[model samples]
Target chain A: MCGALNPDELTLLSRHTRQIEHPSGEELVGESTRVEAYDNLMRGVVKLSKTLEDGRQQIVGLQFAPDLVGRLYAGESPMTAEAASDVEVCRVPRATLERLIERNPALRKRLMDQSLRELDEARDWMVTLGRKTAAEKVASLLLLIASHLDPEAAGERRIFDLPMSRLDMADYLGLTIETVSRQFSRLKKDGIITITANRHIEVLSLAKLQARCG
Target chain B: MCGALNPDELTLLSRHTRQIEHPSGEELVGESTRVEAYDNLMRGVVKLSKTLEDGRQQIVGLQFAPDLVGRLYAGESPMTAEAASDVEVCRVPRATLERLIERNPALRKRLMDQSLRELDEARDWMVTLGRKTAAEKVASLLLLIASHLDPEAAGERRIFDLPMSRLDMADYLGLTIETVSRQFSRLKKDGIITITANRHIEVLSLAKLQARCG
Candidate 1:
């Protein structure tokens, strides 16, 4: 997010950051809990989710490298953060980052812009979750993962490991796992995508996939 | 959102603002259209929506008096804003506000905080859209309106005009108009709410209404 940071600012940030690696499925931070560290993700993916008292879950957001994960202000995090894949993070103490942000307008503006972009993304997904058909939802999620995992590969076939499990995908899309799988099978039958070893996905055509996302 | 502005800053803001009044159903901003002004709402409600290519529309956000309604950064608006009721706004030139924000960190932080709050609300609504039942969706929307309309009336009956039409409610909840009407009737039959003139809604018991929001 701090893509505008100068070399001196980068050095200042590096002084406060400590690198850490986490395995998939690790809980980086719990919902409604205070956070002591603000993670600047260097690699891998993270999933943010909220759970109901009865255990129904909804994955609200997915974060990739260069995204920050923690409470921006104070109080407690409203969503839980979990590692969706083997992840690396440059974790900075919350207070240090907060102090730096207060002093550095560049840092403040970068974070603000990032938060606004995330807000826009969240609203877009609201349309997907609320209005999209089940099959469309599945395709949209696939398109999302494909686009983000290999953003530099525009208009090219996408091949990558699915960052999240099928169960997690079901939760994210507000569909049953069976329904998600059925959509995947339909997509495969239509020659739009291929799956191997369950997690590996190869999108045959971005155009065809976009059509399915409708 | 600039609640922390000093008297001098408020004076400066006033100098840059021109009051405007709009009737209900007016389009304050259109999706994908460039905006010359940023509106600082003075009274009434505004509904922001996104429409799909096939004409399916989803209400993404609702803004109240004291909220700003315009492009924060320089780009075409991603959503359409329509007046939910007769509304008043203090309109400021976009360039003026942008310049002021660039020069004032307080204003910047205020907008950032507001944006973050919006992000949280959007995610919360995602959970409602993804997991909550149709009945719960109806109840949750009612609760949201009641709470926002009269925050001081906690633990008491709530009486206010419904801001949006039943059709709009259906769009927001991702339900058919018939389903939304049926749910309202069910709530009325159960003595949880009373609707008059198809617009005035009197929540009989906020506690019972909240219980239904689950």
Candidate 2:
């Protein structure tokens, strides 16, 4: 991991950094566009997606708070990044970042660590997408969101607000909206979760949810 | 990418680095095991895979010559790294590699670049796993291998040897072996490719294969 940056390096980075906000469903970066800056998400979530020539789209990744937003060393964005919710991010121009990375070894190492972590997460998600059943995929996604929303929650029951819509959830989980909805209802009837109005979900039993994930 | 390490740093790394070989089908690193070293594949192909408790496995990524073999910062190996063909690697201890990264900025930048590249590839594969049909997936895999094996081949016909077996191809494409074989037959029947003995493949029409990938 990037160990630490000196004060001068930090000051140089801060001088080039600017904060920006986007509303829900806003496109942060369009696919194949020239990447101008790196955005570090300060709040809310973003979905990274790609679309085929025939208009089929797949949500490849979800970026949460503190996740870096752009690909480094690439001339153009490979996927479209859209704001899943109202989000705030600190943006640094790509040129400025490259300069900072050249001068600050710690920052470069940190970026490398971030990329490796993302790669690991992407590979894990491939397993879910390729091998898991629809039910298991939904359960895995819920568990992912629950843990991301509250990392310290270690109890029998937990609750979190769904950050994205059911349609987005279907895209992320590689299922149809009806299938996702049916699975949710099944989980609710099975007493594994309680879904209230406005996309609020309370996981009644972590054990049961994990069982469903299998 | 550790670009042009200083002579002293290079010597230091080389001192700790040793060439090792693994036979095809040998497991190099087991999942969840303690990672002790970093491997730089010098020859042949390797597959990084993960398996479920139910014994379902997915080949998440394929590493070819000159690709790094192990995750840097993580303690436990998240996926199993297996030799897809008889492979040789330059093995450097994790501690040594970390020290090299810390002391050599160029090496660190190179590594960071490598990680970012891998992340990009992983996201691309996620699209294939989540959205592509079985035939598309098989075509995509073929295209991937064809391009990797011979990037300079721009003609209508190209030939390359597949490093892995049908089972591995099925796992990587998220399809049954029967489906993969059937697709190959379909492609052959359609005059898209020719499958020779010893897993050799000749792509008759690259455009047709690309069309199938859609």
Candidate 3:
């Protein structure tokens, strides 16, 4: 969610934020915990997930650096949030953040714009959940990862880091780990993407990947 | 999405509202058209929907009396909003509402609460989209309609009104119209819910409906 933040607005928001860091695999917010603070990520990734009664885990949303987390002024959180990598965040107390937003019209506008964008992303995920095939889902997930790594690299052949494990990717995409692995293997077999041992992926054929995504 | 509103907040929100009547089958916002204003239903119902390139329609969400429409400050709507019945709405300019929210912290909090609730609902819908069977989908949709009709009548057996057509229900459940009809027939045949001539439904057995919903 890009914001049209002038320097003045940016400075105002920054004034209210405090820097905080968490090591990889640390729980940022636990399920049923009172959401006292909200953070805008300065660096690294987090996964927002929920577990079912049968212990099946589902990855609901992912927060990249610069994305917001820990629901602003929400009463309670239904899911758990954890840092998937070494994470740096700028945290603001719920009341302070609310006060700032209420005072600054531009900040409020930016927040509303971000909320709308998140809503659109959720709706798009609905399409994937409802109709897309496993291969298409894998392709879409890769496309998301590639764009996040470098938005300009979306149309180019470039190496990108895969932030999450195959298990996390499987949960996020509503597929089994085996299915995710199989799809990645199929992509490599078709000369669409090259995977490195260190979890780096190179897009060999962006158009072909897009075709598989549909 | 219903909320408890104090008299002052309710009056302030209702102050600039103008009620307009819309018959069934009226489109409040269409695809590709820029959304100019947000609306709140004063009476009746509205359905939010989107259509695929192949003409497959999906009802993304529904709005009841006292529910807000359009993205709060967004100028263009991603989904079409249509009158599911002879509906009445209080339309307000986006700028005015934004200003009102900026000035009133309570109002802003209420709006954020609503958005978060809607987000949670969307996530629950994701579970259905990703996992539930067609029968479960239809059952879930019917229960949602039933609850909206009367929030307090959860345990009691009761009949409720259907604001939309079979086709609309079908779209919302991501099933064929025939499939929806068949599901209703099966439910009625099995004594779970009874359907009357004007699209009215009576859940004869709540337990049976709940069982089918899973």
Candidate 4:
């Protein structure tokens, strides 16, 4: 979030872009699909996941607005990516992106910066996966969702909507759906959040959420 | 491993690098320490870890030779990096690296490619953390370490040494030390691997390991 590209940079980025949309439940990248084109998330959420032969599955990552999808220069995708919600993404062919990178030094630099930032996020998630408790996991996910929902409200304490379903949350956090529901109930009972209809969540105390995260 | 920068490209990668070596058990980037530099593992291995106030610890990652250690330009390190063994690293000052990027576009592209590769590895680890059993986790860790240890061994089945300790491996895999040890024993009993010592593990059945990974 710190090293965002300026208008000129954004214009340079737009040179390699094409738009495509995926409805909810659509697969963005399929199993055994060759990595033909990469995408930059323009709207909605996508989940990168894999399924086992026995039918168990795990959500590897959540790609949000402005997040880059697919391998930059790789020839194939190893996992499947599905639209967790309705998604609109800017598709950039690998060859075209390579040409753009080769032609524009500033564009290449910006991409380097973005890649480094994504690596930092990956390392942060490592902490989440390795150390955090189930309660902390849910808390961290909520906080993350809140921060992304409204960047303006990120610095200050404020509530935000959870865009994904409880099942999605369960898979993403490596917990059962029942555990996710129980955690939600616990949070609501503790006055950390208020749940309303249509899966709306109102964070009551960001401080309390942070405490639970720890 | 195939498309990564060559030795000559690696030489051109010099951008204000500082060489440092830490003996076993020394902490490099502890929690609360300012992450002023991005480190590349020139030799040996480092363990990235974190501990809660309650004394429970988790090992998030193991930085091996030729792996990049820190997130470039990160304002803070989310976990502590300690010497898993005696380790040698090339540390680059963040601002200096920025200046170098401004001057050299080709080098920036190379680094971006490196970061993207790391991002893929992290996502793979996310799946391991989310879905894999302890036995599968150890098996996956072995496969990863094998690839890093011997790129030439690709397309051929071979075993390799695990650089990290059982405790370190357990922490990284999000399992208790005893659990990790038990998984190793199970694998050994199943003829998946031959444990010569606590540190030396040789893969006896690569196909079995892969199947176990699934």
Candidate 5:
């Protein structure tokens, strides 16, 4: 988010942020609560989700390293945020950031750019959730993770650890755990993706995977 | 979005806008096109959607009066915007707004606020798409429209025209037209809502409708 700022401004903003570490599965922010701080991820991942009153949950977005992790100007967060893995973050006080945003147009623009990008992502995922078949949904999730790790890569092989557990994947995809498992097996059998040790994944042909994501 | 500007600034911004009217079924913005301008809704509703390569489509969002209609900074639009009803919009050159956003902090803040709000709404809809039942989805759509028409209303009767056709509702709810029709009939039979002329609806009990949203 400091990409738009000069070195002096970047230094000024960093001085106000305090470093914090959270273990996997820690609740960093609660649903419907007043936001006190903005956490900028320096390592690992965080999952953002909302739960209905009946306990039905959906993972709406995921944050990776170097991403800012808070809703700005909304006063209260509409979703709960959990540390999806052991993570390090720089916690900036909400007031401090708000003041900076008010005074610095570059800082505000950078944050706005992030917000716009996130909005685009959320809308794309809506299409996936609303219209995609179960198999396509799984492939889309993999494609998202791989693309994030390497934005310009296509038709290339990729090997990485699935950042989310099967249960979390189910929540993210809006599918049952059994369906998620079945899709994984099907993908493996189809020579699209290979699995090892449950969470490890290797995309044999990203082009093939993308074709299936319709 | 001119809400945050002073009178002089508002006039300055208004001077750059041209009024345009689109009848129902007009395409305000095409998907995957280079967006040269932003349309500020001065009149009616616009449905925003994305279609897959093989013809599958999903309506990602709806825009009402006083809403700005276009993606900013993301050079190419990720979705299409179509007029859901007869609409009037003030068209402003995209570059003009870009310049204003760069120079005016309040204008930047206003637009940022809208983006953040849209992000929250999108995430909430993700839960609906992924987890909500057909019945709940139907109820949620009604509740959204009713609540938008009157945010503080509950337990009271509301009479309004359905903004979109049954086909559009089906697309928005991620259900088939038959399923959407059945849900409407079920709601009417249950006395939760009453329909006349197909497009006119009377929500008999908003509290019941809210409860049914799940």
Candidate 6:
């Protein structure tokens, strides 16, 4: 959306926008609170999650660089947005962004495009959460993280750092931490991935990982 | 979006739009096919689903009246869209709708708003599918259907028809037909809902139903 803005619009945006950084594990937006700003993530990752009444948490979605971080035109945030890693975002006041969207068709279209893409991705994740097995769930999460962390090397053998912890991964995949760990060990035993450290993962065989995702 | 359109834009839409009715079981869009037209559901219900390589199907979403049926600006549909019941939709060529969106900011914002709302709903459903039990899942589906079918009577005691069959409900809820049937019977026995027939459901106690949707 920012790419399509004209000089005047860019100037207007700069007037209201501020760059803010958050450390890992910081809550960026609280659930059910009024949305005060529209954030454009410029660096690092964030997780959108909801907590059940009994305290069970589920990571509903993840946002990467260039993704919008808050709901626009809505009164309150539906889920909590947490910094999965050290994060930087361009924060624009909700009212200012709404006014800008009203005046700029290009920006509005860009936002619509982003929302549609997010909706598609969310639905795809629903399939994994609802139907995929525990091992497949772990593989799906790994595949998702790999594609997001290194888009250019999606189908190729590569090594990457995990932005979130194993507990977060287990929550996102809707499995127990032990189950997730077991799956990771099984994958390692089968030579699909190598755990360099707790957070670093080496993809030994992308083909095998993809097959396990099924 | 349609409600905010100007007279000239409405005329332009009317010029190219065609209304079509589909039977209960017709597929509106196949998974991964190029989207040729943008559809607005005028009546009845639609289900968006994805199928796995092993032939397991999971319904990711349900669309009601005035909801957009296909994605805009995307090349291919991510999931298969099928009519959950007798449906009516206003179909416009994809190119035509794209051009109109470019010309109208309100329409773009409306679509963006819709997409964001759908994303929120999808995330909420993810929590249900991932963590909720079988009886809770059935209760959740019933509550969802009742609210959509009659929004004004959501919290009040009311009755509404189920748009889809037991199999469709099972697919959407990520449970077997037997489990879904057993849950329905349990709900009836518990006096949370009264089964008028196989497809008809009378929500006798909205509070009890909500409690069951733990």
Which structure among the candidates has the greatest lDDT?
A: 5
List TM-scores for all candidates, in order.
Answer: 0.94, 0.96, 0.82, 0.85, 0.95, 0.95
Question: Where in model 3 is the C-alpha error above 4 Å?
Answer: A1-20, A90-93, A99-106, A154-158, B1-19, B93-107, B154-156, B178-191, B211-214
- Comparing only chain A of model 4 with the true chain A, what is the TM-score? 0.85
| Alpha-carbon DockQ of candidate 4 | 0.57
Query: What lDDT is obtained when candidate 1 is compared to the true structure?
Result: 0.88
Q: In angstroms, how far off is B180's CA in candidate 4?
A: 0.9
Find the 10 residues in a row with the least total lDDT in model 4 chain A: A1-10
Give me the displacement of residue B129 in model 6, in angstroms: 1.4
Ranked by TM-score, the better of candidates 1 and 2 is 2
Weakest 10 consecutive residues of candidate 6 chain A by summed lDDT: A147-156
Question: With candidate 5 superimposed using the best TM-score fit, by how many Å does residue B118's alpha carbon deviate from the native?
Answer: 0.7
The candidate with the higher lDDT, 1 or 5, is 5
Model 1 agreement with the true structure over A42-132: per-residue lDDT tens digits: 8988999999878999999998879898759857999999999999998988888887888787778778878988888898998998899
lDDT of each: 0.88, 0.86, 0.77, 0.75, 0.89, 0.87
Q: List the residue pairs that clash in candidate 6.
A: none
Q: Please write out the lDDT profile of model 4 over residues A1-214, one tens digit for every residue.
A: 1125456656766776767888999988886689878777888888887667776677777777777777677777867888888999888777766766676665565667666666667667767777778899999999888878866864436666678888888777878888988999999898888988837778878888988876
Cα RMSD, model 5: 1.8
Q: How close to the true structure is residue A199 of candidate 4, measured as C-alpha lDDT?
A: 78
The per-model DockQ list reads: 0.78, 0.78, 0.35, 0.57, 0.88, 0.74
Which stretch of 10 consecutive residues in model 5 chain A shows the poorest summed lDDT? A147-156
Off by over 4 Å in 5: A2-15, A150-155, B6-15, B151-154
TM-score of candidate 6 relative to the true fold: 0.95
Interface RMSD of each: 1.0, 0.9, 2.3, 2.2, 0.7, 0.9
